[model samples]
Target: MRDNAILVVVARFLIPLVMLFGLYVQFHGEYSPGGGFQAGVLFASAWILFVFIYGLDTGLRVIPQRVIYALASLGVLLYALVGLLGVALGGRFLDFDPLLDAPKAAQQTGIILVEFGVGVTVAAVVMLIFLLFARRRADTVAAGLDPDAADDVREEQQ
Candidate 1:
């Protein structure tokens, strides 16, 4: 993998652009079709591309397993906290009407926060799934077993 200089160089240039686009999709979602789901996929894709190009070990080094787990939990907590805070403020769950003095501002703030939470959770989960599968493949190959065969065995059991 290290010998592939062209792939390494191209990934270095493209990954940041992909991330920026993901952020755009996330922040601009309130006014556009894209939102947390799209942004999360984009972000996960960027990291997936990185892992595909650079290897899973490198990807894990950049973002550890514990960090991914924490991010997944934090995202859900963030979303729940926002809704609970609204309730505490005397509004219905997720109402966001009392978050700020101006109802419109509060709504906007609430939407953005919820969207961000969704994005974070989605991205973390996708990454976690990919990592798990990648690890399984690596282990299978290491054990001299056919990964496809392993998949077939699991499917047959199911």
Candidate 2:
């Protein structure tokens, strides 16, 4: 990890704010330029910044790999479950009319729920990607080799 103490402090402060902004974007998407997918990426990027500055092991300690995987799976399940609810109510897949007794409200609520799920899945997957790359880089550096050496090795092999 690059140990610029000032940068670390700044990142620590910025990360939560960015995460909070992501939530705002996720929830206010109906009336905003941002949406669940954008929010998720933003949220994931915050963590990625932390990982890059603090190191992969520290990142993992903050958010366990197993938990991230589980959350990603759960997000998919949640989205599917909402669709199933619509089916059970005699509507087509993801038809939100059955989400509530009031059809209009149901549609709105259903959209929100689906968006939430999407955000969760997107965030988790992005973070997972970062984790994998960061871990590989960390390992390579620890092995007394340049982390970028993998690219050269691959090129040579080819």
Candidate 1 similarity to native, TM-score? 0.90
Estimate the TM-score of every prediction. Answer: 0.90, 0.85
Q: What is the C-alpha lDDT profile of model 1 across 15-67, one tens digit per residue?
A: 99999999999999999999888999899999999999988989999999999
Model 2: CA > 4 A from native: 141-158
Give the per-residue lDDT digits (tens) of candidate 2, residues 77-140: 9999999999998998999997689988998899898999999999999998888777787678
Off by over 4 Å in 1: 147-158
Clashing pairs in 1: none
lDDT of each: 0.92, 0.88
Lowest lDDT block of 10, candidate 1: 147-156
- Strongest candidate by lDDT: 1
